[model samples]
Target: MRLLQTQITPFVNNFLHIDVREQPFLFCPLHGKPSFHAHPELELVFILEGFGKRIIGNQVTYYETGDMVFIGSGVPHIWLSDPAYYKQDSTLRSKVIVTYINPKVFESMFIHIKELDGVKEMINQAAKGINIFGDT
Candidate 1:
């Protein structure tokens, strides 16, 4: 990430969702670029198209289509798309579905509930980020 631009994640009805696509068009905008930002909401990201690098906490790694990751609340992260995706004549486009979970809501609804032990544990585990795979 080139910048630390932490800010309040805008939510639509207590959650934030971002989706983008391209047809036969050329040039794709940077999906979420140039920042290591953190917020109070937990994040889940599923990459449906393109490949690039991601920084979650101190972990800097590469990500491609079909990769799914969950980032805990307050963890700094960013997704930097490949250069070709931003090129004017390139056909490469990045598509991802990103969802943010409000911790206050999650805690009130699931974290402290008696029947949601598994969910509570999972949310706690997500504080360090997770890579979901295979039928999950």
Candidate 2:
């Protein structure tokens, strides 16, 4: 996958390497123009309020409030807000909560635990990106 100009180092150094970083309030406009980016860490994103299109690998999907997605390592993706959100007069805003996870860390802890097989499988699937739905 081609790496985008925006690298994930800041997030990695500031959040992932230390602990699972949970940013409960993320403003969208700060992300600027949507650009495809990839990183070696897995990410979980919850949209509290927003409307946009998400590009993950070959799939392009539209999303709004309450949309939650789990993206895997090295998978190129980005969330592009709707054009209206970029307008100066528009009051619309995008709010999100993001969590970054380093699968390698968990692997070291659970690799020998047979009980965590299901969890391991899920992590493997996340490498291709997973869109969580419903209340569960």
Candidate 3:
């Protein structure tokens, strides 16, 4: 017979979702360009309505209406309206909401379901961010 030692894992150790006290919103002027910034919380970005290019890590993607994305913590990213795709006075440039979430929240939610195993796997494979291109 082999003896096995039991080890206790701390509750929510190394994992804890960030508590966002308020909604997420980021805006830049039509001609303004912002630098990439990182946060401790995960981010969920949904384009209410707009056409712009998102630069995450080394990936640059263009998006239209209904587009959405999920950005992981500490990932450097930025969105800039493609000047070739819009006018300087257009409202489309400032319509993206980047919602933040803590990674621990995801891990905790993922632990509760067996069916979500696949989803959990997918999340692990996701890059710094995942982009959802909307139907044109």
Can you give the lDDT of residue 88 in candidate 2? 73
Candidate 2 lDDT over residue span 1-136, tens digit each: 3447344545565446423222322332225445678777777888778887888888999988888888887888877778787777777766776777765676775768889988778878887789999974
Candidate 1 on 6-41: residue-level lDDT in tens?
Answer: 544454366555544533221222333355667777
How much lDDT does each candidate structure score?
0.70, 0.70, 0.55
lDDT agreement of model 3 with the native: 0.55
Of 2 and 3, the candidate ahead on TM-score is 2
Between prediction 2 and prediction 3, the one with superior lDDT is 2
For model 2, the stretches where C-alpha displacement exceeds 4 angstroms are 5-33
Write down the RMSD of all candidates, one decimal each.
3.9, 4.3, 12.0
Query: What's the lDDT for candidate 1?
Result: 0.70
Q: Distance (Å) between predicted and true CA of 128, model 2?
A: 2.3
